[model samples]
Target: MYEKLVELQSSTHEEATQQMVADEEDRRRGLEAAKLQLAEMEEKRNVSLLTPFLKVAIVETNSPAFEAGLRSGYQILQFGTVTSTVLASQGPSALMSATAEGVLLPVWVREEDQGEPRKILVVPHRWEGKGLLGCSFDPIRAK
Candidate 1:
């Protein structure tokens, strides 16, 4: 009976060791998966001349576009190309002297395809959270 009890204890220890090994393997796989996910997110956040910010104007102050380094009075020659839309303040442009906070402005200005400056409004999906450099810093495609 004593020998049987010892045998049972040995079996339990072996089982525990196997469980520990399995758990460690699971943890390793989970960490690898997390790393892969982070790499994918970084790749997706890349800025390319394809999607997202098609056109970019100059920079401004206290503006989401400005926080994104978008200036004002410049030219959104690229992403603003085709039929993309720019989110500006809408409704009343008044900041104070009103009940509500203010209006949201997102104007959609399109460049005429006719003999113009030949600006390319190419926005890459990768530039999602990237800082907005000057619009003219890119290579303008000649028409």
Candidate 2:
């Protein structure tokens, strides 16, 4: 009878431990979901406050963009002859079209709020890896 009681107690302890682990996993999943939702909300808020302008998101090492002093977070106002909303809507395709044929396209960059916008020439050239322009961009939206 004592042996039976001991065995039953061990089973109960194992079940309790398993329940604790399951509960922890459930809490972890809930926390992860909450974190993801928060991140999405933050991104939406950031987009809402920004103006409709394209900004460089990345510049690859030793690429033409990098060599031309193009860095991440630089706002691109004009891509060649295109400007404003037109550039915002068709920036990526326009960039590809303008640069794919070894053309030197003029790009206006507003580096700072107090500084004047300056133009830079970009030649889209194929490199060792990834994007042809060696850069990525994000559209800035108005608040």
Candidate 3:
């Protein structure tokens, strides 16, 4: 009878050890999945870093910017010879407003089809629209 009791105890101990091993394996798999998810998020962030700026939210019909072929979802890469990097750093509103009147503001834009940014000359004028440029922009991060 004593021997039978010892044998039962041994079986219980073995079962408990197996359960612990299974639990540890599950934990390891969960941690690995979390790491993979974090890596994917980092990759997306790095890709966005290449083009940092807001996309045009609106392009008023018949406006100068619209006449120049500007459209919504297009990213304004530059506000002239100045790169978006420089303009973005100085504040988009201030730099854009500082442009001299009648000076054809050369701009770089990334359209849907364009592989890289293309230069587009936009002549800002007080037209029948809401804003000076007749367009609205929202930062990518905001989206």
Candidate number of the best lDDT: 2
List the candidate 1 regions with Cα displacement exceeding 4 Å: 48-143
For residues 19-131, could you state the per-residue lDDT of candidate 3 as single tens digits?
99999999999999999989867743443344536578898899888998888988766565444566656766655664555678866677755555665678787888765
Candidate with the greatest TM-score versus the true structure: 2
Better of 2 and 3 by TM-score: 2
Candidate 2 per-residue C-alpha lDDT over 24-109 given as tens digits, one digit per residue, 9 for 90 to 100? 99999999999999996774454333333678888988887887778887887666655555556775576556666476876667
Candidate 3, poorest ten consecutive residues by summed lDDT: 43-52
Query: For every model shown, what is its TM-score relative to the native structure?
Result: 0.35, 0.56, 0.54
**How does candidate 2 fare on TM-score?**
0.56
Q: What is candidate 1's CA lDDT for residue 108?
A: 30
Order by lDDT, highest first: 2, 3, 1
User: Which digits, one per residue and each the tens of the lDDT, describe model 1 over residues 1-143?
Assistant: 99999999999999999999999999999999999999856633432222222334443344345444344333333232222122223322221211122323232322323222322221222224443322222223333
lDDT of each: 0.39, 0.72, 0.71
Candidate 3 ranges with C-alpha deviation above 4 Å? 1-50, 112-114
lDDT of 1 at 37: 90
TM-score, predicted candidate 1 vs. hidden true structure: 0.35
